[model samples]
Target: MSAANKGKSREKPMASLCAGAIAGGFESFATYPLESLKTRLQFGALEGGKPLTPLQALRETLNQGGTRALYAGCTAVVIGNAVKAGVRFTTYDQFKSLLKDDEGKLTAPRSMLAGLGAGMMEAIIAVTPSETIKTKMIDDSKRAQPRFHGMSDAVRTIVREEGISGVYRGLGPVILRQGANSAVRFSSYSTLKQLAQGSVVPGSQLPGWMTFGIGATAGVITVYSTMPFDVVKTRMQSLKARQEYRNSLHCAYRIFTEEGVLRFWKGTVPRLGRLILSGGIIFTVYEKTYPLFDSIF
Candidate 1:
């Protein structure tokens, strides 16, 4: 490519990332309560039906402290997800440039690869510190004189005590989750959208509502396919299990052996619910909004 074209390409991805961050931040804020609930459900034992239904989880969270407890780590989520989502969309699109067909049309396989690449990139760039802090905040196992008081405190503590390494505890499962999630999400969204459009090349686009529907469908697929990995990542990152589980593989093995194979699917219900809504919000907002950034920058 010419230098001029290369320079132009750089700017476009930057704008897409900016627009994506805005959309992601909005979606994260809107859906964070469900996110918190999902995190709770992922914790504790799940066998014998015991306790902790979704409603019970909600009650427990509120009763644990106050209404504010429900949004314990919302700040970390919003910050991490803004950058993660932005990078996901930007890298997917950027990688698509390399994977597209001669006619510049994206195939399902190519789109999946691009999305996987985007997911890996987001994990490295945005998932580690934010997720570590979020997990630590919500994890009440250390409720007795918590190690970190809040987000800023958590960051300082991790950095001071464990250095940079502490902030990236569950990176293995995080990468697995993000990579699988983006592959399924982008591939399914692209396929459904193209099937709806009845075209190989980009043609007339669907309405905003239909685009949302497609995105939700994709999110549902992503939730189930990657829930086990999500559970591992959450456990590995959360304060409670960080010491219990040695690593991602150890976490998975313990869950399968002790918690039962089905336990790996813990919290999938809330996650599906959350992701379906978030998927619609993300794709709809990003699609509707990014074009404006494209026009301007």
Candidate 2:
């Protein structure tokens, strides 16, 4: 390859990373409130029947703490999402490059494998503290003292009480859901984008809107496909204050036995909505910003 071509190729990953971070930041900001509500709906029910509807929860949260309550974990969310998007997009580019030969054709399964690998790595590195804070914030409504006042409080509390491992309470389910979610989400989005591009004019490509739509569709599929694990993870992490379950797998088994299989998909509706909006925004921003970054850098 020519030196210019190599330089352009090298720039793609960095450009994608920048674009992804911008997109992810916007996406996270937009959907964080719904995400907070979804977390509450999933884990806020008293052990004995009294689950609050999403609207009820939102109303109660506002009544008690005002609108600020809805964004309790926004800090963690922004940081975590920035890292997640950056890594996921950049790694995806790197993986695709590695998989493609000089002919530029990518093999089957390589995309999926790349997504899975990126997801697992991202989950392990980025999920723990942010998730811990998010769970604590969601559970704060039910507590007398509140587990955490803010992200800093949550992190300090986790480390102080249970040490570093405490912050990773549901790491297993996190990895499972995120890994599979990434694999399905990225692979589906890429495949759909490719298909969409094929139908466009010879010298033209699918619009950014098309990419967003495809990404949102893929996000919905990914979230729903791995939602059961998500439920388990939420339950496991949220129960740290309550100590209700031993671990993620135990939490899953307990929910299955006690609440039935349907329990595994609790709050799926809100989750689906959240993912669709978030995915659309993220993909749109990432796709639109990529060219700008390429031109600048």
Task: Give TM-scores for every candidate, taking all chains together and pairing residue i with residue i.
Answer: 0.91, 0.90
For 1-297, candidate 1 gives per-residue lDDT tens digits of: 001122114336876788789989999999888888888788766223474778888887777776678888889899999999888888887887777676656789988998899999999899877887787788742265556677888788778977798889889888988999999999999888768776433444567888889889999999989999888888887765655877788888988988788878878778888999999989888887776777777
**Per-residue lDDT of 1-297 in model 2, one digit per residue for the tens?**
001123114437667778877887788888988888888777744446577787887898798778888888788888888888887777776776676656664444777787888788778888755786677666765565566777887788778978888778788888898899888887787677767767788545457677779878987888779889788878877745346776667777778887788777778777888888877788777767777877766
**lDDT of all predictions:** 0.80, 0.75
Deviating ranges (above 4 Å) for candidate 2: 1-11, 44-47, 239-242
Per-residue error at 119 for model 1, in Å? 0.4
Clashing pairs in 1: none
Best by TM-score: 1
